[model samples]
Target chain A: MDTQQAAGTSVLPADPGALTPAEARAAFRSGLAVPTAGWSRGFAQANLIIVPRDLAFDVLLFAQRNPKPCPVLGVLDAGETSGPLLAGGDIRTDVPRYTVYRDGQKVDEPTDIRQYWRDDLVTFIVGCSFTFESALREGGISIAHIDQNVNVPMYRTEVRCEPAGSMAGPLVVSMRPVPASQVADAVRITSRYPAVHGAPVHVGNPHELGIADLARPDFGDPVDMPEGHVPVFWACGVTPQAAVMESRPALAIGHAPGHMLITDARDSQYLVP
Target chain B: MDTQQAAGTSVLPADPGALTPAEARAAFRSGLAVPTAGWSRGFAQANLIIVPRDLAFDVLLFAQRNPKPCPVLGVLDAGETSGPLLAGGDIRTDVPRYTVYRDGQKVDEPTDIRQYWRDDLVTFIVGCSFTFESALREGGISIAHIDQNVNVPMYRTEVRCEPAGSMAGPLVVSMRPVPASQVADAVRITSRYPAVHGAPVHVGNPHELGIADLARPDFGDPVDMPEGHVPVFWACGVTPQAAVMESRPALAIGHAPGHMLITDARDSQYLVP
Candidate 1:
């Protein structure tokens, strides 16, 4: 057997776009857990938010009102792991890792959430901006953080999201450093994928959004901003997760930051125009 | 005091668009409950769907999956009829007419649903195509049904909508006769409003949709089709109502055909690109 197969490593091929959604999911299911950044290239990566059925309605409404920050890709019924749109995919084992919360406090980070499974837990897979990064790359744009091999920096902003029931909090955003000349191209390309946070919520001024420093983000590693680069911000999937923290549901479950659920749905399928 | 005042008619002013949404809603509240065809010219008109909380998630998912046929404008929380989105509007007494269905059968058509309103009921305002018809009219296209002073014809097709939980049924569509010259214009104008069941679902052929006759329709009145015109069909809001019938929920309430809930939201608010 080849050394590649012997290691049992799910190292992406040289051309990561060749990876399939099902294959990446299988890798996760088989305990080959890792950050799913380069895997399942064309398929959309989703932010999984699982909550007890009692709080599902509030969270669903929160996602609906703050669609730009929390564009929902698919919502699975309570206790049902498989969905029709996902082509019989399993939610419990499909994601590499999960973060479990109790009363808005992070308590445990589990590789598999099989022990925490309950009949009243509702699962919602929200669209991640990672789905649109591929489009920007295809459009001949360079993402600064990806080049640095790190998670995209995210910040807590002053902009308050539209509140629903008990779910209310400030908006969260992920930053990308784009050359001044490519700002319009970035917006144009991202606008097509509204299902993935649409266009940039803020473009030129980070301070206007209550982001004090680009170097120290609330989450993820910061990237260097070159002379000709301007920071662009898109509504982050973390907004709903942050709101969940503020709302303090009895129990909440989500993917660990940077790890995502790769679905069979292609990014192109979510394009509006 | 004046001819217009003596007639007690809220006739269109020189600029009908100048009419405030509150004035239009007040008109309906005062028993001026007629088909809201020309009221609040540029404001959006929505189809009202109310169901018990037990079936709320199923209905919400159904609308999300079959967005074209059931584009939702606002979904109110269970038991709360007042919403911030609608600007202090009350769902129970706001709409002019409602059709109540019990166990998949029509039971009553009530003007105000205040008596039937329950604490566990959830109200949903699904976007009606009537909002887009005004845009079509503004684009210099004439509507046959408006000229003929009749309801747009609707038919049941063999095409099944994506089911959610107990919600499952054949798709229902509304038909309009468009001149060969204006078909493209209709599609372009309506495509801007995705929240209003944007664009034509099927154009030129009814037989392919399992629709056998143009003159005979399951709902609404059939209008005359001119020789130069072809029938164009749009996904109708009645679809969920039909699905409610197929699902046989304990009780389902919806707006009577042709009557809709006019909202403070402008039709332009729903336009995407």
Candidate 2:
């Protein structure tokens, strides 16, 4: 075995995209910390939301009610650390980083959550827009955020989600600049993956969604917009985390923004004909 | 007002197919009891399952895990009756009839369930295969049960659903005998409605699904199979009811077989593309 494997230290593959979902997870488990974009290229990545058992129903209901914003990929039963989505993997240590929220406030950013994990906490794995980015690229549309080497801009819109019990919040959308000629192609390509955040909710004007400024996003970094490029907004995975924050549950946990759980499931598994 | 309307009694429209979803719901609310197949022709009908709030998360998770048999159309939050799926509708009284289950056994089949209604009960409106029957007809495939004037036959399959929490049961499938030539057409048509039971699980042979005999069904009335017809099976909405029966939750409620809640939402709303 290599020295890095023996020491349980990071020796990530030179071509990150070549690593399997499990390999990427193992790297994260071995203390490699980085955003998961462009990692495990053909596999899918998921957003994480952990809430106490008492509040899980509300979260599940919220996802059912607002599927576009909170498409559930799979859920782990309360205290379960592994499921089919993560074969031979531990949820507590698989993700690159985790955000701990207490009473809706950010309290800690940890690499391992076993210390804070509770038997009463249920984990929800939600679809991420990253899964469809490959489809967009295949359809000949370039991703602005990827080109700019920054996080995709996300804004909390004025549109309120269909509330479910105690869970409610404004829809959060991630924006990408699509070339004027390729906006339709982008929509057609991304719409095929409804399990992920499918289709553009808005095109051309960010102000229409109550987004005052493109450069000032509620979360993530803004991409450079070239002239003749239109801003296409998609329902963001962060919407549930926003809901968790607004509801102010006693405890909640989520993947650190931009970092995600790479799953064994392939991207083609989500693409509809 | 017409005498029939004034009496608060049945004066159903001569052409039951012409009645709007609201009108059909009104008929049911006013003591009319009949199968909803041909009524409200263009609107979507739903399967009903009500469980106490304590068991709702498990039910929701179960549905999430097995979406083919339990595509949730909409969910009525606990203690709430009306929502987007049914405008100005009362769940307790609008459905043609309800089957009350006590510890897995059928206790009552009542036209109205107000007396049994509880504040803690959460109602799940699941998609029914009836929505796709029209698409099949439009594709020039005749339905056996409709032609025979009998209920669609359902059977318990050897296939076990991906369980969630305490909810676990064998998949129950509805079988329709289609002419061998139109088998592809039936699958293509029904696959368009993923919100309903999408596509056939098996295209031929009854014994493949552990069904001993096509004439003897686990639920609903069996139909006459034509000489050239092949047994096609689709995941049935009874799957959740089967789970309820096997899990033996203290109290559970479901729509009696062949009777359903005709929602205001149109069938086109559920048809993909």
Candidate 3:
């Protein structure tokens, strides 16, 4: 059996949310494949993107240009498997699952990426909206996706990102139905963590963002829009992946959606104030 | 006569402080070299560093690792001369003066760098402390350097920067003596501008930072210490230049001391809420 099939047979932790970030990573390293939402409570989880050294500068420039959609938490230089964010953890094997892309097409979904590791590849650890969701919950706001027990709904809009070299694509956003009264609190709370996707890009009227149907999303499962709650959109980490897919590099790798790299950094560390 | 010598004979504007950023650049483009301390009062001034494309990534990584000392305002990609920060301004001719270095040794200090421009060069525009100095002054904090009619005193501290590839150097800081009562105000006002070297790195006791004498600064002129005042230091923009010098890149270019690029971006734009 392949690594993915073998990992599928492994049992997951009973209470993954209570595990320390290191412990959670250890579970993934031990061949337990699972989505990482609420895996480490207060610890920050990161979106991963690995690109070759030649295109690394362009990716960094793209992230710098479009910070809302791509807040770089940390960068592991070419051939560097570990850095400040993932102490004692090998990036190639710690993630629960990875999506490998070849010429913009998904070729394999591997449990570990050690076979594909290259000396010229650079890893960019991007901030995920999961960090701010905790803050939003702490502020007495309820998230529709979390309440519905599904992945957050994401849509690609007509808004084009500020392009850097060959990296260019339409802006992608995740949706949540928040009560009108708590919208301001959500914005104020999330704005403090600019390292993650901060504040709502569009508070109401999905049509303004060229999103036709609220029930249909380009990625993830749809959540119910409760009465008296408005649809809110935040810049999604998937925007970079979309750019990579559109740009069509020789090889690209990312964590499977909803399956992220649990980092050693705490959510509070990204809070500006 | 060369551009510098010819520009030395050019007449300067009667009130440079009242000129717009574009007008200031026009004057500098005409080969008139002068310090940009009070020019275009409300607009932002930036420190300039240009390196070959091969070394750009290391510099960007270094700046990311050491943000306080090198807050990147904007970057011009290899062979890219204009961008969002400076509209209609040419990076090569808009600055008041340029310092060219060959293998880390100063080779030229010319008014214009058009002759030194190359297609593979990448320019990095770094934030200057002048943006926050105005905020401090507005908050009722008197600035010692401006009051004493001298360049801000800067010292090389013993604290080493987090290294990235070939980039590594000690943290350099600019000093201003603020009254004990206004130290908190100074911190509060400047903290709002993280893009421009936010907050004081060291407040009192220069010995703690390995500075034996306050009067003998490694760069810039020393200012007087008013009675009941304590020395306050902010990370200097020179830190990157120091790193470039230490790293010994084949070629590097920077703005001469006190001479800066007046960007179209306003000081208020950099102020965080």
Listed in order, the DockQ scores are 0.47, 0.93, 0.53
In the range B67-98, model 2's lDDT, one tens digit per residue, is: 99999999988888887788998999889889
What are the lDDT figures for the candidates, one per model?
Answer: 0.83, 0.88, 0.86
- Name the top TM-score candidate: 2
Q: How would you encode candidate 1's per-residue C-alpha lDDT over B1-273 as one tens digit per residue?
A: 225523546443453346576665554554445566566788898887789988887887788779898887888877988774457667776676788999989899887788888889988889888888888999988877777867778899999998877899888898989899999999999888888999899999999999999899887788898999989999999899999888888888998776788888888999888
Q: Which stretches of candidate 2 lie over 4 Å from their true place?
A: A1-13, B5-12
Model 3 CA deviation exceeding 4 Å by range: A1-9, B1-12
Question: Between prediction 1 and prediction 2, which has the larger TM-score?
Answer: 2
Superior candidate under lDDT, 2 versus 3: 2
lDDT of 1 at B147: 77
**Candidate maximizing lDDT:** 2
Model 2 C-alpha lDDT per residue in residues A1-273, reported as the tens digit of each score = 245843567665687788889888888888777777778998999999999999999999999999998999999999999999999999999998999999899999898899998999899999999899887888888987777767778899999998898999999998989999999999888888989988888898888899999999998887888999999999988899999899999999999877899999999999877
Candidate 3 lDDT over A99-161, as tens digits, reads 898888888889899999999999999998888888888899987777776777889999999
Give the candidates in order of DockQ, highest first.
2, 3, 1
CAPRI grade, predicted model 3:
medium
Candidate rank order under TM-score: 2, 3, 1
> Alpha carbon lDDT of residue B131, candidate 2?
89
Model 1 misplacement above 4 A:
A1-15, B1-18
Q: Give the RMSD in angstroms, all C-alphas superposed, for model 2.
A: 1.6
